[model samples]
Every structure is written in C-alpha cells, then in structure tokens.
Target: MGEVVFWTIIRTAIVLPLLWVLKSYLNVDLWWTVSIISVYGVIIHPAVIHYRLFNEKNEEIIEDTLCSTCEHFDKTAVLCLKHDEHPTRDYLPCDGIDWSPKSSDKSQNVFDE
Candidate 1:
C-alpha cells in the first residue's frame, strides 16, 4: 500500500510539470483532453494495478492469519503493532500468548444488544 502511494506521488510529481510545459504549445481544448488522459493513464491506472497486485500477493497473510483478528494487527501494513513485526501464516509475532480480540468485535457484540 505504501509502495502504491509512493509511486503514485512520484508519477504525479513527474507528470504535472511536464503537463504544465505542454500547456503553452497545445490549444486549450486539446490540452484539457490530453491532461485528463495522461493523468488517468500515467497516474491513476498504474496505481490501481499496483494496488491490486499488492493485495493479491498479500491475500493469504491478510485473510487467513491470526493477526487478522488480533487487536494489535494492522491490516493496512500487515504488521503486529505490539511486537512491531510482520505476521505470516506459520508465524505470529507474539506466538499467540499476547493475542487479543479487536476492540471493534467487542463493540459489535454490545451494539447487537
């Protein structure tokens, strides 16, 4: 996720200045169309593709691990907040000794009543 965001920032930084330089040469209507297409093609599309790939690569770790249900787990980074380590299918940062349910789960039980 961070990688996706970082590269998108890099692409935007590069594309915006180039677009500004092209503005003077192209007619207003043509420039607008080009800007829209370039922004989508260069910036948005690649980000979406990279994000999907990231998710696909991390799918098992995200969905099947004990960290998925733990309070210290950070799904966005797939990190264990308490141990400051990444969790995998066969490995747990705390080895189940320090595991705790997410607060949202408790909240849901209360809300149901």
Candidate 2:
C-alpha cells in the first residue's frame, strides 16, 4: 500500500508539471480531454494496479494470520507495530505471547465505567 502511494505521488509529481507545460501549446477543449486521460492512464491506472498487486501478495498475511486481528497489526504496511517487524503466516513477531486484541472506544468505556 505504501509502495502504491509512493509511486502514485511520483507519477503525479511528474505528470502535473508536464501537463502544465503542455497546456500552453494546446487549445482548451483538447487540453482538458488530454489532461483527464493522461492523469488517469499515467497516475491513476498504475496506482490501482499496484494496489491490487499489493493486496494479492499480502492476502494470506492479511486474512489468515493472528496478527491480522491484533491491535499492533498494521494492515497497510503488513507490519507489527509492537515488534517493528513484518508478520507472516508461519512467523509471529512476539510468538503469540504479546498478542493483544484491538482496542476500541467501547472497550475503553467499559473499563472506565
């Protein structure tokens, strides 16, 4: 996910300046159409593809692992926040001993009450 976002930012950085430069040479109607198409093809399409690939590659860790339900799990980065390590199906950063449930406002309220 981070990779997808980072690359999308790179593409946007490159595409926006080029589009700005081209606007001077093209007519309004033509430039608007081209800009929209180029933004989608160069920036949006690639980001979508990368995001899909990221999800495919991490599907197991995301869906089947204990870390997926843990409070320290970071689904976007596939990282364990507590151990600062990536979790896989066979390996857990803290070996289950440190696993904790996700904290929610409801749970906190119960404890507070």
Q: What is the per-residue lDDT of model 1 for residues 10-97, given as tens digits with 9 covering 90 to 100?
A: 9999999999999999999999999999999999999999999988988898888788888998888888999998888889979999
TM for candidate 2 is: 0.87
lDDT of 2 by residue, 32-82 (tens): 999999999999999999999999999999888889878999999999999
Error of 2 at 92 (Å): 1.3
lDDT (CA) per prediction: 0.91, 0.92
Name the top TM-score candidate. Answer: 1
After TM-score superposition, the amount by which residue 79's alpha carbon in candidate 2 deviates from its true location, in angstroms, is 0.9
Residue 41 in model 1: lDDT: 100
Instruction: Provide C-alpha RMSD values for all models, in order.
Output: 2.1, 3.1
Runs off by more than 4 Å, candidate 2: 104-113
Residue runs of model 1 more than 4 Å from their true location after superposition: 108-113
